[model samples]
Target: MMSDCPVVSTKLGKVSGFALAKAKCPEAQQVYGYLAIPFAKPPVGNLRFKPPQSADAWKGTRDGTKYPPGPMQSTRYVEIFAKYVANYRVADENPRYFDEDCLYLNLFTPKTSNKAKLPVLIWFYGGGFSAGSSVGYHGQTICGLQDVVLVVPQYRLNAFGFISFGKNSSCPGNMGLLDQKMAMEWTRDNILAFGGDPNNVTLFGRGSGGISVSSHVLSPMSRGLFHRAISCSGVANCNLVTKENNDVSTGFLLKELGIMDRDPEIILAKLRSLSAKALMEAQEISAEYHENPLQKLDDFVTVVDGKFLSKHPRDLITDGNFAPVPFIIGCNNTEFCGVLADRFPKGFVTGEIGEKQAMDLTKIAWQVADNIPSNKLDEGVGLVKKEMMRYISPDDRYKWSKLPTNVMLDTLILLPGVEQAIAHSDAGNPTYMYYMTQQLRMHHNRAFSKDMTKKPEFCEADHIDDEVFTFGVPFGNGPVAKEMKFTEDEKNLSKQWMSFICNFAKTGNPNTPMSLTNWTSFKRDDQRHLVVKMPLEEGVDLMGERFEFWQNLRAKMATT
Candidate 1:
């Protein structure tokens, strides 16, 4: 049946895609998937730390069914993928996979006829700058649902992608971002052949990838790449920024490899001499700087390089210099709660006064950002506690007082999301915001692995749950859905969510699809955001008092 699919002729060569009959779309005969096309030359040898080059055009048809190897990353991510991720399809089963020559892109088209030029949806994956692959997302069914073309590009990671050495061309940092830019350029030049409209491209991603999309919004180099963006659970102002002169971390890594010199040229040569695996293993930055939450979470992240990113991303967004495009931004309610819940003792959540008092304010506040001063950390924590008190009834204080889940959610996900939405709205671009509230039937934490086959228990909408609904993969159709036995509520919610995203891609406005509820654009004054649940509810002030507390504290934090 797959042999019936047409062969696409690109400038490089002729390649035929596999027919995807499993797609849930009834309008299309079948979706075609063209996998593992090289978008850039391998970043090997001298090209290791430099920006990616154009892929060398080939003479013969390459096998497009098999996914290309992903960028170099630690194998621990594979375990994390199995343990934590909810929607990993068959393509994502490769746990022990990594390579340097992994600059590839996968394209999925719903067009049964080559004459149709559909809108394009390009996805960038997130793994704290260390892990993720384009193969994980089963994009065929998702794209087929709306007859849109989907593109997923692989970029370098960790030491290979983000090891900055003070802004010179030899070892300039942000090579990962440059790789994304190169992929966009390739799409701009070649996507039409795959039946995609280059002008109607939408770039979207979750977590680190979402931050990358926000970074692209601020970068001058990514201006003409895409016309719209959908960033979920990550933003530039969320303290995700790393230091530009990351010499402290890079130098420490170089010294570990017996290269003690501070000279850029010498360090570059030494770095190139080391094997990819060895270099990846040498990514041990000092823990002394753990006070800074960003450094503690992911030190090797995007930086404000002079070329790719000239200024601080938040400053750029505030100054209205970012790409003027429609945006859909949201975050899960309890994103990191269950992940960190066990760290606190049982008495912590039970509101034992002594147990609550035992918890250190400075350490907890540091998790928010390293910039908070010692004098102000306790005060901020006190303010947060007071706000939480108001939300919980006097009878429920014991149940709510333990493990600062609300604090973490507000500091990391909510504050930054709302801030970015406000900034984007102020910059004269239409922005839509939402808070995902539906609890999903999946694992809350990786600790429970007794029966991986039996579906994990239901948990509050945690991080990356939105991706499952957005992609429309195994859940979109197949035996997995039959096995999982999704509820009517789950199916309805996924359909609504996918419809909203598809509508946004087709028309800049998401409100075009009258079948769905009327979604309103966010403004500074109204601050309206759709509370996404089974029956979607609109609210003007989401966590109003808590938001106000943070808004006031941010000014003081800025002054300090």
Candidate 2:
């Protein structure tokens, strides 16, 4: 590995990285990959529960050939979800590699020399804000095909990353977000050495990572760090994205860890002293104790910490107080279906009780406030039920049913996404909205087979389908079964999507040269959004009436 590696000098020291192999791209350029480069000091021992610090400069050349250990987090849902209805899956945590000291990053560059000055695209992976790593995504294809510098950074996770005690909290939380901020600062100051244009940095992410991107836009500390943003299937205003306060779960975790002291100093000391495994287990036990998945989560998630985040992201955006940058916000046709399908069994949706169940599911998906009156709840549920019935047929089974899937899609993803686009556009940013409707031949959630009849009953594109195009991975070359093949249309769609994303990274607009149609900027009055499908077509008023119904109902409820 050392013989053919390329050596580069960073602020810390001189480092060597291996060249990427087998990426399908033009012969003129090759993708160079550097893995597990430390951006911050290892947050262990006394540094636990604290913000990240810059890594110590090394004396000799360091090898950045191998992937580093990821941050400590549970793999419970990942293992189960991987069996059937999931796209991105995390394998069981390897204790040997998993550690608290996981503040690392990876970089991929297509430029042979630092003079190239290509646009830099930074990716943040999403695992419900708990389970994910930079190693999961390889930047070879994205960088090689798009001719941009790609960077993936690792941040702390779960309780270790986001644990705030209370109002006068000892540990100022959002350490994970801070880690990302520091990574951006490092990129802005140092990316010029890696053949990247620091001023043209574009931050893009999926799911929880998208939520993080939106949060960064709303954050004062993250201002001017990134020049553009793309959020796929995530919004900061979504109910599940942020919490009012996490005191209940924080207290629960402390008691489970056998720390009786409520004092912040003592609690911090006890938390820092606990083993990494023990800390993870405490949160896992707390999650299990609160069996209801919809309510308060046991694992730590984002909260409105007064320091990093002053107010709700929606409130901030609505008031025209977020980072002013071009925005691309979108959700898949079936954003939450892959995971939500697991909750309903084979013949569960076949009666009057099924109606009640569907209503309950919609309520949970929207995270409806308890303060809303029962009459308003019934009105809202009735309207949603009417809208969902249009998609559900009588013969459909639980697995094939579109009722619950549509409800989840509208309530969780589409509505929040449009809401965000509206806010950003009104705030004077050039916002582009989209709904991804393409079903790729190769996707992690899709069970592949040559026989078309053997395909699963789910029709809509599942979560993370658009991710394949975003990363420039060809359909046949993905992690799915090898028997499947990519068609001409699939290849064209992938190329077109990649072109749009690369153009967005280069210039804030996604409308580029290759595609036949021009992606128009989002207009609040018409609410036009590009229906991202095989033959990309523009659609007016996406879910317009249905979304308006909910918005009106909400407004009416607010008045009463």
lDDT (CA) for every model shown?
0.71, 0.73
Clash tally, candidates in order = 2, 0
For residues 3-80, what per-residue lDDT tens digits would candidate 1 score against the true structure?
776788876777777776555545434577888888889999999989999888888787787778878877755554
RMSD of each: 3.6, 3.7
Worst 10 residues of 2 by lDDT: 84-93
- Clash pairs (backbone) in predicted model 1: 348-402, 349-402
Quality of model 1 by C-alpha lDDT: 0.71
Which tens-of-lDDT digit does each residue in 1-560 have in candidate 2?
Answer: 44665687888887778666635545325667677888999999998878889888898988777778878877665553343321211112232357788998888887637688899988888877777777556666667777899888989988788888654566768888889998998888778888899899999898889988888888999998999999988877775657766676777787787788868888888888889998988888876654345543325777788867887766777787788899998888876555544455454333323656666666555443222555666666666677667656766565234565676677666777888888889878899988888875543333443422221335456676677667655621234323444556766777788788889999998876666678888988888888888888998887767778767766776786
For model 2 the TM-score comes to 0.90
